[model samples]
Target: MTPLAWLAIGLLVLVLLAIGLGAWRLRALSHRVGSFECGARRAGAAGAPWVAGIAHYGVGRIDWWRLWSVSIRPARTWSRYDLVIAGREPFVGDGPDTYLVRCRYHGQDFELTMSRAAYEGLASWLEAAPPGRRNVVV
Candidate 1:
């Protein structure tokens, strides 16, 4: 092949390598981005829900959790999120109605960027015993 052709091929390879490296770096960075409002490293996948809380948050704020530990003799209950995870950070407004609470948790901070309406919809799930009542499942 001509010298010019070889040089062009080498330049193209270099460009490809740079692009690949940049992509890899971005992927790693995103993992630390958290959902959005959290500003911390995301511990789980974006769409991965608690499903059944395979693990715990392993956090120190367990004293505040108040799970509905009431045992109904023969009452069946529906499954739903105990925590509201959503929305971005630096919330401009005030009160819980302004943004979304993480609908679920992955034992990390919380999935953010949901919406006020979304948090309201979780009324049933929010019922629970109280906030930060249950111990960290981890």
Candidate 2:
């Protein structure tokens, strides 16, 4: 084979290795991060489209990471103290068991679409916050 062919083969091998490593990383993260898949959209933004992501519940906050991105940093985070559930409704066309929850974090509104069980778990997490740590506005 020519040198150019060898270079092409090396590049192909690198790409495959990168994909394998990424898959391994994602699987390990899922196991240790306790993350749940969900869809999110910011409220009041023009043509705000729902983006698929995973939510990782932390000690006093929740971090969101885009599902298809390679970045390790969270795309968004909401403190339990400032997060508030504004409303909930059935997520149209998703299913009966899925719901769309409207929430406010530091006055910024966003929506999360999750399963019924996940929604209940989120509610419980918020309500279980330590006393004096929550700032209930309503």
Q: Best candidate, lDDT-wise?
A: 2
- Clash list (residue pairs), candidate 2: none
Candidate 2 per-residue lDDT over residues 7-101, each given as its tens digit: 99999999988888767756655666557778898876637788988888998888887776667788898888889988888988788999988
Q: Write one digit per residue (lDDT tens) for candidate 1, span 43-125.
A: 35655532211011112221111111122121111123334334333334345444423334444455333245533333333
Quantify all predictions' global Cα lDDT against the true fold.
Answer: 0.35, 0.81
Q: RMSD of candidate 2 to the true fold?
A: 2.5
Q: Alpha-carbon error at 51 in model 1, in Å? A: 36
What is the alpha-carbon lDDT for the whole of candidate 2? 0.81
Model 1 lDDT on a 0 to 1 scale: 0.35
Candidate 2: worst 10 consecutive residues by lDDT? 129-138
